[model samples]
Target: MQNASHRIRVYQASDCPELTRLDVSKLGRAYHKIPKIISTKFDSIEARLGIFFLKKYRLNALLSNLTFDIDYHCKNAQIFSTPYGSIGFDINRKFLLSILHTYYGLSKEGNTVSLDLTQSVTKTEDRLKIKLGQELLQLTMVKEVLNETLELKNDYTSIIHQWPYSVRFWLEGYDEYCFSILLDAHHVDLLLATSRVDSESDEPKAKNLSSEQIEHMFNNMPLTLTGRLVSINLTVAQLLNIGPGDIIPVSLNEPLPVFIENEQIFSSVVAEERGRLYLSEFNDKTPEMKYE
Candidate 1:
């Protein structure tokens, strides 16, 4: 005989008045807040799952009279013995049959199909396993279903595999026909891998100067030159007695020295044209006399 000590009485929607009136509107505004109200008395299991499936896949999955039971296991070499929960739902059999019919081109007459459940392991060996189940095996196609359900080509397998925890989904209101997957610590790391933002360096890089910028810098530069060949040493009385039309004699043969920015760079001969002084016969000659 089977052990009755392990069996626990589970309640249905008809047995509870609060479960019958549950609706999706009772959930809070944020999608992340639904996890807190999942096991509350105000909302039914089916209602919470319906909202979750709808928001995640945008599919109108019909779930009815959902219920879950906690199962405790002993420590084993292959599986972790932590206490975990399993939830069952009466799925719309026709909707599930239609998906298999459209994709794999399988007949819609059968009520069940085989599925593979892969679990990520976090032991020192870094190993994992894939198990087979009858009805629950169809969950392997969940990524494909999500893509078809949303009418897009997005690959959602990577997103679904990031959940590092235990979650079980049962269909046809039967515990024997269920799909289950476990995500260990390694799987959680994959989900949080992209959370950190990379920091940028504060130092500026060298920029190449454009032609316009070089032209602007050259146009703003000032150029100065002084044309003086000799300085006449005059006493204070000779400078004060000087008047207009006074001719101070000097040697015209001496070349005028041109100082650019107070530096003697070139020497030029002095020339007169139309009573205006001009520099002519320029030569690269350093002046021997220094300017004070």
Candidate 2:
């Protein structure tokens, strides 16, 4: 299931004694000193999704019946700035990726979500709505919907996947852009294969796309053996430290020492004539593999 548990907060009069003793400013200022704040931070998703939910099922109070959860929002969300970036949520609160130069953190350019539209997300959406029914109902009852389609920092597409299509939207060009959305809080728990936030070498782009696009590329791409290890990179400092002509030794000394991940594959020797490399006798057992 979606795993969205509803929280029924029936507001009763606060303890007058406690209120009189505690300073409102100390409690971060009194919000809803009246009774309660229903659903303010993010507009209750009822209006946009209410009719569909109500007709598809039951009934409830008017649209305005839903109230904003003022306290939770005012407290949980904050004004944040980092070397990565800066963001502010003037209204409800949005998040962003602070890709600050020289800062130690994940860059906004990397770490993106791929939308597999080929996989249907209707099931996921339904489960999410069901699990977080109150939230959806709140939206409907309040005649408001969460702004799901905020500006995607990177390229993005909308598709229905297996279910619980959750993603952390990292906004760069925009402020208060970082936030997460998916089927249910649970599905995000069982995430399948995940790409690194930063694929230092080669990484695919597209925060979203449909099934056909994913499938089309998945099927057409050549299955290049990933075990191939072409080079080992070292910093300039390591090279400059070499005195005279120090022999920087490597592990495998086989003639065909090409490494597929760890295992040794086609073996070749380093032959430099005009500052270029030539591999000879690659995987050659009987004969020496030579370069052209």
Candidate 3:
């Protein structure tokens, strides 16, 4: 690779414009769009579905990183029996959460509610719609399911390449809380690429053509040499037992995760001065950034 950077050029256009289903053309046909509404509660949906159980997000991130103009649905989330015990996973996030939309249709509007500094205002289904572009943003999180080889990027990519499938979704057209993974893949890809400069010959590109002056632009970021986030989240009971002593659990250790688009590009340490929080930075420059 040029300057020890991964220069990516591949792109993926999802099978259907309607993201309620998996494009099983790559991952195989065994996967299908089977959405099941929790119907119970929305609190920590990803926790119940299990995201902290995921071992890694590299391949999933790569699959997602390469494309931007499609829709994917995280339809079926389940736990499977394995020798290692019950393994649960979203199994479809590569197509869903990875491909996001900047714009969407907003349904029910929300009213402003007042809150107190010390008042406990939590675990509420704040059913509010925020207009994006062609689609509306709904409650979303990276869900997980039981899996064995999830840590291996290639095995995952191989399975995804051969049998790409979509999930069953309850889209946002009619309802707001109901979810789907509809996205402007083209736009997403364009933006992700814009974050990186491929080569010295790379054209003057970017949505605003002002990467040269972006305030957030950095020559490098911390590298995620080796790490993972595991089982986490506090139950209401755990949150309710507050009158006495308590300890909240977290999957992240010293170095928390960093990403351009939630892609887990690095692990960083958090610091604070008086009250405000800060993150320690390191070097992990992508190709385009190097040329710049």
Task: Return the number of clashes found in candidate 3.
Answer: 43
Q: Which stretches of candidate 2 lie over 4 Å from their true place?
A: 1-130, 133-221, 227-292
Q: What TM-score does each of the candidates earn? A: 0.22, 0.17, 0.17
lDDT of 1 by residue, 1-292 (tens): 8866776888886996432222243222222322222223223444544564456434444433223222212122123211221111122223333333334435336645543223232241122111112122223212211111111121213222222233344444443433343433332232122121111124453388789978997996656768985667789999898999999876544688888878888889888877767788999976479789
Residue 277 in candidate 2 has what lDDT? 52
List model 2 lDDT by residue over 242-281, tens digit each. Answer: 8886877655343435655655545666555566555554
**Against the unseen true structure, what C-alpha lDDT does each candidate score?**
0.39, 0.34, 0.31
In model 3, what is the error at residue 195, expressed in angstroms? 26
Cα displacement (angstroms), candidate 2, residue 215, comes to 18
Which one wins by TM-score: 1 or 2? 1
